[model samples]
Target: MGKVAWVFPGQGSQVVGMGKAIAEADADARAVFDAADEALGFALSRLCFEGPEEELRLTVNTQPAILTTSAALLAVWKKAAPRPDFVAGHSLGEYSALVAAEALSFVDAVRIVRQRGAFMEEAVPAGRGGMAAVLGMEREALQAIVEAVSAEGDVVELANLNCPGQIVISGTREGVKKAAERAREAGARRVLELAVSGPFHSSLMKPAAERLAKVLVDVPLADARVPVVANVTARPVTQAAEIRRLLVEQVAAPVLWEDSVRTMLEAGVDTFVEIGPGTVLTGLIKKIDRRARCFNVHDPASLDKALAELA
Candidate 1:
C-alpha cells in the first residue's frame, strides 16, 4: 500500500460545538479536552463543546480552540488508524502537525497558539489591516501585482498560496483593496475580501513573529517521529531547532501549501487524512493532487469511515 499522510486545519475550521461528540464518546478524546483545559488554565473544552459563537471566534480563543479540537480528533483517530508517514498543516494548523509528529506535546502547543493569536491580534489594530483572496490568477502575475501595490508605500504581500489559482494577499487595508482591484484588472476571475481579524502572514505580522520567537525558544521540542512538511519551505522538517525557526518565520511567511502537498506526493504519500474540526485540508489536498485519496475524521461517523479505509 502507498504511504498515508495526516494533515490538520487552521483558523477557519472552527464552529460551535466541535469536538463534543468525540469527547462524549471516547475516554482518550475526553482526556485530550481535559488536558487542554488544565494546560491553558481555563475551560477551553467548554468553549469548544459549547461556544458562545463570538467568544470562540475571537482570534485569541479561536487559535487554541481549533488546536485543542484538532488534537482531540487526532487522539480519537489514533485509537485505530495507523501512524501517518508524514504530516502537514495549513497556517495555524502547523502546530497540530508538530503534535502529530511527536515533536511537541499537545499541552505546549495549545499554550503557544494562544499566545501567538494574541500577538497577531495585537500586532495590528482592527480596520488598519486586511486580507483578500484572488481567484484565477497565476502566481507570477499576482506577485508582480502585489509588488506594485507595495510600491505605493503600503505593505502588501502574498499570504496563503493555497492552490494553483487561489492566493490570499494580506496588507494594510488600503494596500489590500488596491491589490484586489489590480488583480481584477489583471484578469483575475474574482477577488473576495476575507473577514479576518488582522493581516496575517504579511509584513504587518513581524511583530507577532518576534513575540512568538521568545515563546518558542523556551518551549521544549523533540525531533519528529514522522517527517513534518513545513509551511514556509514546503520541505520535510525533523530537527527541533529548525522547526522552531520555521514556525516563527511561518507567522509572516506565505504558506507553501501546494508545494508541501506535492513534497509528500513525491515522497510516495497517496492517502491524505485530515483530522480536525472540518475537511478544509482534505479539499486542499484533492485540489493539489487528485489521484491521492483523502479522508477526514472529525466525529465518530467520519472516524469509522477513515478507519474502515485505512485500518
Candidate 2:
C-alpha cells in the first residue's frame, strides 16, 4: 500500500556477459539489445554478452554497455512489475532513470552516454586525476579535509556521498592521495583508491560538462512520467529544460545519493526496486533505512527472488 520506486545502478556494477541470459529468455529484452547495437552501429550487444573484459571496462564502452544492460533488464522487469511511484539512479545511472521515466528515448540516452564517457576521460590526462573511497568518516569532516587539500592548488572534492561512512573523493592525483592520508589520520576506517580513469564528479570535470552541454541541447526530452530525483539536487525534477541543465551540471557535481534516498523515503517510498546489473543501490537503501523494503532484478535468479519478495 506504500509508494514504490525503481532505482538503477551505475558504472561499477558492470560485468562481462551481464544481460545475455535475459535477452535469450525474453523477446522484449532481446529487442533492447538489438536496438542498442543498431543505434551504436556496432555489436555492442556482443561486447556486453561476451566481453573481452578489457574492452568492456573502457569508460567509453562501459557507459553504454551498462546502460544497455540495465535497459534490457528493465524490459523484462516490465513484464510483471507494477507501475512505480517514483524513480532514481546513481551517477551514470541517472540516464537510465531518465529513459525509464520517458524523459529521453533509449537510443538518445545511449549515444550521449558514450560521448559523456569519452569527454570525462579526456577532461583530465590519464593518471593525473583519480578517485578514492573513504569509509567510516562523516561528511563534514571529509569535506574539510578535501577543502584543505584543494586550497593547496589542486582540485580535490567529494564525488559520491553514497551512504553514511562511505564517501568517494575525486581530483588531481596528489590531491586525492593527500586527502586519503588526511582521512586516515582523521580516523577513517580505510581509504582505498578506486579503479577509475579520471576524477569524475569534481570541479576537475568542468571541461567534460562543457562538452556534454552541447550534446544534450538538441536531444529531445519530455516531462518525466513519474518524479525523478535529480542527483545534483536530491529532489524531484520533471521539466525537460531543467533536466537538461541539471544533467550538464551533474558531470562536475557530487552525487547526493544518501540525500536522494532520504528524500524518497520522506515522500513515502516504502519499497525500492533496483532494475539494473547489481544490488549496489539495494544495499545502499538498506543502510539508509533498513525498514524500507528493497528488491532487485538483474539476472533470472535475482528476478525470481525479487518477485517472490514483492509478492
Candidate 3:
C-alpha cells in the first residue's frame, strides 16, 4: 500500500454548496453536519448549504463551517477506503486534522474553531489589517522586502509559505501595502491583496493567541492515532499538551505549509489525499513535489475515484 497522508484546506476553500453533495449521498456524512449544528448551537449547515456568501465568508462562521464540511467529507471517505497514515491541515483546517487524527473530539473542534474565529476577527479591527500574496518571489527576498518596508508603527511579516514562488504577507494595512509595493520592486511578478477579515498568521495576532491559550487549556485533546503534521512546526505532533501549545501559537505564527508538506514527504508520505471542499491543498502539494501523488475527495464521484486508485 502507498504511504498516505490526508490533508484539509482552510478558509478560502469554502463555497456556497460545499458539503451538500456528500451530505445528500451519505447518511454518515449527514450525521456529521447534524452533530456540528448541535455542537455550535446554530444552523451552520444551513449557512453552508444555502449561503448569502457574505455571512459564510465571515471568519467566525467560516472556520466552523469549513471544519464541519471537511469533517463530513472525511466521514464519507472513511467508509470508502483505509484511513491515512498521517494527517495535516492548512491553518483553520488544522482543527479538522486534529479530529481526523483522533486527537480532538469533533464537537469540541467545532466549538474551539468558532471561538478562534471570533477571537481572530476581534483581534484586528476592520481595515486596520490586511494580507497580500506575493507571487514569483523567493522567500528570502520577500522577507527582506517585508523587513525593509516595515516601520515602527507598521508590522508586516511573511505569513504563509505556501509553496515555491508563493508567499503571503500579513500585518497592519499600511505595512501590507508597503510590502506589496516593495515586493514588486524586489522582483515579485504579482501582488494580490486578500479579501480577509483580519491579518491572520502574523505577530499582530498575539493578543488573539493569548486568548486562545486559555480556551485550549479547557479543551480536551488526546494522543493522535495517526501523526498530525502541525502548521507551526511542520513536524508530526502527537502529545496532547504539545498539540494545545502549537494550536495556540498557530494563530499568530506563520503557516509553515511548504515545510509541513516537505516533512511529510521526507517521512514517506508519498500519496496525499485532500479531504475537503477545494483542490487547493492538492495543488499546493503538487507544486512542492511533482513526483508525489495527490488527489481530492469532496463528493461521491471523487470518493469512488480515489478508492479505485488506492485499491
Candidate 4:
C-alpha cells in the first residue's frame, strides 16, 4: 500500500546453511552461488551450506558468505516482489545492497568484500582492538563518554547508531573497556563487549579503508538502477563515483542506520523487506518505528509468505 525499501543485514547475521534452501529451490539462486565460487576460486557455497562454524565465522569468510547468500535469496525473491523504491544495508551488507541495486556486479562485490574483510582483519593486531554494544543510553551522552575516553588517548568512538537506545562503540580494547565502564556508570542499561576480530567502524580502520580503496580502483561500478541509501551519510546515492567513495569511507565511518531508516520513512517507505540471513534489521526497524511493515525472506517459505503479503 506504501513505498517499499529492501534492506540487507551485515556481519553477525551470517549463519551456516543460509543459502542452501534457496539455491536448492531456484536455479537462478544456485547460479548466484556458482558465480560467487567461481569469482572467489573456491567452494564458498559449500562453506555456507555446510560450515565448520569456526571457519564461517572468520571475518574474511563471513563477508563473502553473507553477500553470496543474500544475493542468492534475492535471485529467488526479486521476480515475485515489486521492485524496491530504494535499497540499503548495514556495514558489510552494503555490498549486497549494491548488488541488488545493480551498482556492482555480484562477482565483483563478493571478491571486493573478501578483500575488504582481509584488510579490516589486518588493520589492527589481534587482542588490541574491540567493540561493544551500549543499551538504554542517549547518543549525546554516549558520545560524551566516548569523547572523554578518546581525549585521554584510548580512542573509542561510536560505531553504529542502530536504533533508539542501542549504539555500538569501537576502538582499542582498553578504550572499549573504559567506554563501557563510563556508559554503565552513566546509567546505561547494559554494555556488552563484542567478540569481534577488530575495531570496525572506527578511525582504527583507516588503514583498512585505504587498502580497500586501492582494491576498488580497478573494479567497475555502474550508476545504481535504484537509489541506494548509503551507510556513511544516511542519504540516497545513485552515482557510481559517489557510491565508490562512500564504500571506502564507510569502513571507518559510523553506520547511521537509524538516520538511514528515517530518511526512507520520510521518502514514503512504509514497508521494509529485509532479504538476508536473519531478522536483525527487522527487529531494529520495529524499534525505530513499530507501525512500519517488515518482512524477512531468507528461504522459500519466508519468500512465499512475504510475496503474498506484499502482493
TM-score of each: 0.98, 0.98, 0.98, 0.99
Q: Residue 169 of candidate 3: its Cα lDDT? A: 98
Clashing residue pairs in candidate 2 are none
Which stretches of candidate 1 lie above 4 Å from their native place?
none
Better of 2 and 4 by lDDT: 4
Using lDDT as the measure, what is the rank order of every candidate, best first? 4, 2, 1, 3
Tens digits of per-residue lDDT for model 4, 111-166:
99999999999999999999999999999999999999999999899999999999
Candidate 4 — which residues are off by over 4 angstroms? none
Which candidate tops TM-score?
Answer: 4
Q: Check candidate 1 and list the clashing pairs.
A: none
Instruction: Report the candidate with higher TM-score, 3 versus 4.
Output: 4
Please give the lDDT score at residue 16 for candidate 2: 89
The candidate scoring highest on lDDT is: 4
Native-to-model Cα distance after best TM-score fit, residue 20 in candidate 1, in Å: 0.3
How many clashes does the backbone of model 3 have? 0
Evaluated at residue 15, the lDDT of candidate 1 is: 94
Residue pairs in collision within model 3: none
Each candidate's clash count: 0, 0, 0, 0
